[model samples]
Target chain A: MSSSELLQFLISGLQSGAIYALVGLGFTLVYASTGIINFAQGEFFMLGGVLAVAGVRIGLPLPLAIVAAVVISAGVGVAMERIALRPRRDSGALVLIIITIGVSMVLKSVARHAFGPNEMALPAFTPGPPVLLLGAAIDRQVLWIWGLTLVAVIGLTLLYTRTRLGRAMRATSLSHDAARLMGIDTAGVVMISFGLAAALGALGGAAVAPLTQTAFDAGARAGLKGFAAAILGGLGNPIAAVLGGLVLGVLESLSVAFISSTYKDAISLVLLLAVLFLRPQGLLGKSGREKV
Target chain B: MKTRRSVLATVLVALLMAAALSGCSGKGNGGSKAGEGGDAPYRIGAIVSLTGSYAGLGTPEQKAIEMEMKRINDAGGINGRQVEVIFEDDATDPAKAQAAVARLLEQENVIAVIGATGTSQTMALRDDIDRAGVPQVSMAGGSVITAEFDKNVFQTPWPNRIVVPFTLRALKDRGLVDVAVISDTGGYGKDGHDLILKGATVAGVKIVADETFNPGDTDMTAQLTKIKSASPDVVLLWNAGKEAAIVAKNIKQLGMAVPLVGSPGNGRREFIEGAGDAADGFRFAAGKILVPEAYGEGTPAFQVAKKFIADYSFAYGVAPDIFAGHAFDAFLVVTDALRRIEGEATPASLRDAIEATDGLVGVGGTFAYSAEDHNGLTEEELVFYRIEGSTWVLDK
Candidate 1:
């Protein structure tokens, strides 16, 4: 590929990589606090986009619509935790994971009925012609995705290090019994993690909706990809998950351009397997942190 | 011991009574109403993609079928037997479609099967349909459905065999001879992709670049970027799912100035709605229901399309797209055949009657099925449409 063509593919990869990173953050957040994978993370992304579209149709401004969507999706995440997971707090990890799968299915069905079976798009935050950057065309939405993902990452890092709740969440992830003995309300931390993860995912969805339209059934494929990204970056490490997502996106884009677009997923799957076989802890993950 | 034996016998008798009563209830209205002489309903099975990637297409198809069923039964039924449609949701999976067709044929005892909304799903029903010896009127537009030539199968829409060559010729006439084909790996897209390759040679066009993506993929920028480097005169998209909108948006986002042309699969309101302004100037070939004038003023075909559009819009609060028209035509073909049956309406007799159909006016143009040809519509029934301002305008 020519230099310009390589740059074009990289830009495209980074755009989708930003989205996968945000969804991976959701998976990392829930897994860190609860020790269970929230399979419904992709539904939060779908809800964010679909709700934003509904908000825009109801006459809200674009920014306001996105904010509303994020807030509502966060609320849904909290509700899911309280109604489904709270009662099953004593349940094993396997049971909780299955419950999350059930919740995702219910959410998908409800979204279908509420949004109807059609793809919906949100207007660009700043609609204009593509910005030509070094002989490569860049969508304005691409900039929005990168900016929002950075903001989410910085904000989450601050929350983890600076806030008391963040410290409590860390302590809980370290050892649930010890954290409880230390008088930390670990359950509340878990709930907040769900909300925060959902907000981050929704923000990504809202930003990307202008580029890729949202639909009722958009969650499953996105969820699977995000899950793969989370696994690629270590399951519990949030920062590594983001890096993993970016790596995955670039890999998929380059494969499509250089090799074959038809085998992009297969190529990604082979790489994922290689990562798992070589280092099961993920790229940035510490070994022996998770038990099989 | 004798007392315990008597109690067990009583319990068994109660269980048998419950089973007998439940069996009677399971028969529904069909058993009670089958008194004699055409009081029974003509059961037809409809397998639709009510929940998956093709849900947008199948929802409209289900609505059109239900609407037509109401109209036909309200007019004192089809030859004194009310048309009852048993609907099954395939969820856009071929396996589900196969299972649903098996149940429809063996259990529901439907005289006809109307759909398996998408091309792959429809093709999946062939084994069951052939085994059951029933007439299956498909709503999908893949040419393989008819070109493969199953005697028991009939299609309502213009197949890709007719549309692909016409589309290629149209591109050639516009002085756009170089083509870049981006098709999905699904049934309809794969089918159209093969035919496009064959027709490009016959239509005197050069195939410059070819790329494909799987269904449900969210990004096509990489494919479009490759196409950009090749700089084809036109980008031909062959996909029936909602993902077609993404290609249009991707082309616009990448600032690629190539005109995007699509197959009949792109002829839907969702395509315009999903792509927004990016959908402007997008072109596809489809039937005349969008612009009834394409049927010609005061023609019988025009009158039928006009009524269907108005009725469908009133019922659903929006205009019917080509999928709806295809479903309407499928229902019309089956009911029209049912009306023409002289004696007992077995699947064999109904299949023969449908094959003998000639010159019946309905939504995707007039129908004329034969023993040799299952898809009756020709190139004349199709017109080129350009999407302008999120609505399709007849391309002059």
Candidate 2:
């Protein structure tokens, strides 16, 4: 490939990987706090995109629509924690995972019925033509994606280090019994994690809605890719997860460029399999001593 | 609280499973033996993707069939046999479709089947349909549905063989010579991809780039960015579902200003609406249903097109899309064959009658079926249209 072409592919990959990072970060946050893989993370992403589209179409300004979408998704996430996760707190991991899958299906069905089967698109945050960068024309929406991703990462990092609730949630995730003895509201912490994770997912969706049209069934693929990103990082590590998402994005783009486009999905998956075989706990995952 | 919570999750899981099962099994319509003037209602089966990725395509087909069923029943059934239609949701799956077709043939005892809406789904059910010796009028856009003709299977709508060539010719004629083709790896998209590869060569167009993405891929920017480097005159996006819409928006985002041409799958309203402003200037070769003026005054196909559009819009409260028109054409052709049957319509007789269908007026086109050529429509039936102001206008 030419230099410009290579630059184009890299930029495109980073843009896509940025969205995956946000989604993967969501997965990591929930898994860290709750110890349950939230399969419905992508659905919250769908909800944000769809609701933003709806909100804009119904006469709200773009910024208001985005806020509305993020808020609504956060509300749904909190409700899911209370209604589904809280009730099933005593259930096994497998059971909880299955329940989340069920919840995902329900959310998808509701979105389908509400929005019909047509995919939707929202106007870009900055609706401008592409800017020529290093002989590669890059879209303005892609800049929005990168900028928002940076903001989310910084905001999340600050939330983790500089906030009382974030510390309490981290303590709860480490050991609920110890957290309880220290007078942390473990249940409330879990809810905050769910809400925060969902908002992040929604924000990612809203950011990318202009580039990738949002449909009712858009979640499954995003969820799978995000899960892959999370696994590529440690399952519950935030910093490595974002890096993992970028690696996957670049790998996928390069696969499409070098190999056949038809085998892009297969090749990325094979790489993921190879990574799993080599490093069971993920690249940056902390290995704990297991009695079993 | 513990037992109650456990019961709640169990109940929710059970309810979800039940919903999933019911979705798969599909609900029957007008299967009542209680209908008058019949010993037993002559069961006709349909398989459409009622709830899945291709649901946008299949739902309209199902709606058209349901509307036709009601019209047929209200008009005192097909030749007084009291038509009972059994609809099955294939969920856009091939294996599911094969099972559904088998169930419809064996359990429902349907003499004829009207669907398996998608190409792969139809092709998957082809074996069972051939074995059962039942007539199947398919709504899929694959040329293989009739090219490698089964004695039992027939096709409605212009397949990629006709659509791709017509589109390529349009591109050639418009001086948009170099083309970038992107298709999903799914069956229908692959079919379009193959056809475009062949059609571009025949139409004397250079393929600047060829790309494919998975069916549910959220972003096509990687592929689109690659295509941007080649700088083709136009882009041909082929897919059965909404992914192509993403391609439409992606092109604009990437500053790729080439005209976006698409397969018949993009002829639907949903595709246009999904693309929103990006839909403008999008071009495709489709049946005259999009621009009925192209049909002219006093043509047999024109009259059928006019009425089908009006009645379907009246029935569904929205303009019937190309897929709906495809199913309507199949319905009309099948029902017309039933009307022409000398005696009772059995699988053999219906197959013969359907094969003998000639000069039949339906929404898609005038299908003149013969034993050798099961796909009755030709390139003459198609018209090129460009989306202007979010509505398709005939490309003069």
Candidate 3:
């Protein structure tokens, strides 16, 4: 590929990669506090976009619609934790995982029925001609994704480093029993983390919806990709998941260009497999320190 | 690891379902099926993609089928035999389609089947349909449905082979020779891709570059960039479902100014809505039903399409999509055949009668089935549409 052509692919990859990062961050946040992989992470993403579309359809402004979507999705996340998991706190990991999958299925079915089977579209945050960067036409939505992602990461960092609640969540993630003994209301932190994770995922979905139209079942793919991103970065390691998402996106775009576009997923799989085999702890993850 | 397991499980179930499907169809024990009694309402079966990937297509198809069923029953019910439709949701999975077809054939004992909206589902269900000695009028528009013709499978929509030439002819008219074809690996996409390759070859057009994308891949900038490098005169995108709209955005995002011509699958309002302004100036060849006036005033095709659009909109409170028209046509074909059967409306009787379908005009245009040809629509039924000012304007 020529330099400009390569830049075009990279820019596109980053745009999508940002989505993966945000979704992955959701997974990381939930896993960090709860010690459970919420399989419905994708469903949360879907709810965000679907709700946003609904919001717009009902005459809300785009910004208000997005806020509504995030809030609703966060409420859904909390509901899932409270109704499904909080009662089954003593259940095995496999059972909890299965319940999350069940939650995802139920959410998908509800969306399918309520929304109908149409791809919902929302106007871009800024509508007009796309900006030209190095001969590559970049949709303005990509900037929204990157800027919001930056804000989210920075805000999350501040929360973790500057806030007592964030420290309590961290301590809980490190050792639930120890944190509880240290008088850290670990359950509240867990609930808060689930809400935060869902809000983050909803934000990602809203950001990407204009670029990629949201389908009722689009959540499964996003969820799987986000899950892959989380795993690639090592579960519970927030920073690494974002980087992992970027790396995965770039790898996918480059593979499509250099090899054949058909095998991009296969290429990603090979790379993911290689990573799992070679560095189980992920790039930025330390041994057992960040494991969920 | 979870994804891997799920993929493996899906494959295994698919293989087992295929095996069961073939066995179930090959058994010519239609007499022993549950719907054997001649006393009940005439049973028709429909297998539609109600949930999965093709749900958008199948939901409308299902709604249309229901509306048609109500109209038929209200209008004295196919020569006094009350028409009862047993609808099954395939979830757009081939395995699910297979299971649904089997249930329809073995349990419901439907005289004929009308859907499973996507090509893959239709293709998967065809073998069992043929084995049960039941005719299936498919709503999906894949060349493979009829190209590899089955005596029992009759397609109602204009297939890829027909739609491709129209778009290609338009491209050639504009002196656009070099073409870049992008196809999704989904059933419709793969079929249309291969046909576009053939269509371009037949038109003496050189393929500058071709790219394939899977269903869920979010970005096409890589492929578009490669196509830009090749500098094709125009790009032909042949993918069904929402992904095609995404391709339009990808084209806009990558600054690839090449004109995009799509298959009939991209003819839906969903595509235009999803792609937003990116859909501006996009063109494709689809059934005249999308633009009824294109068939011209007082023409039989135009009148039928106009009524369908009107009746569908009135009945459902929503503008009917292409798939709805396909389903409407298929339902009409089956019911129309049933009306002509001399004696009992058995599976065999319906099969032979459908095969003899002549000059049957519906939303998908005039369908005429012959001894060898099961797919009835031709290129004449298609019209060229351009997205201008966020509306589908028939290209004069």
Off by over 4 Å in 3: A288-292, B1-39
- Candidate 2, residue B197: Cα displacement in angstroms equals 2.4
TM-score of chain A of 3: 0.97
Ranking by lDDT: 1, 3, 2
Tens digits of lDDT, candidate 3, A240-260: 888888888888988888899
Q: Candidate 1 clashing pairs?
A: none
Question: What is the alpha-carbon interface RMSD for each candidate?
Answer: 13.0, 6.1, 6.9
The models' CA-based lDDT, in order, is 0.86, 0.82, 0.83
Global lDDT for candidate 1?
A: 0.86
Error of 1 at B58 (Å): 0.4
DockQ of each: 0.30, 0.33, 0.44
**Shift of residue B10 alpha carbon in model 1, Å:** 50
Per-model chain B TM-scores are 0.91, 0.91, 0.90
**Against the hidden reference, what TM-scores do the models get?**
0.94, 0.92, 0.94
Candidate 3 chain B, run of 10 with poorest lDDT = B22-31
Q: Which 10-residue window of candidate 3 chain A scores lowest in summed lDDT? A: A283-292
Q: Cα RMSD for candidate 3?
A: 4.7
lDDT of 2 by residue, A177-285 (tens): 8998999999999999999999999988888788777877777667777878887876666776787888888888888888878898899889987987787667777
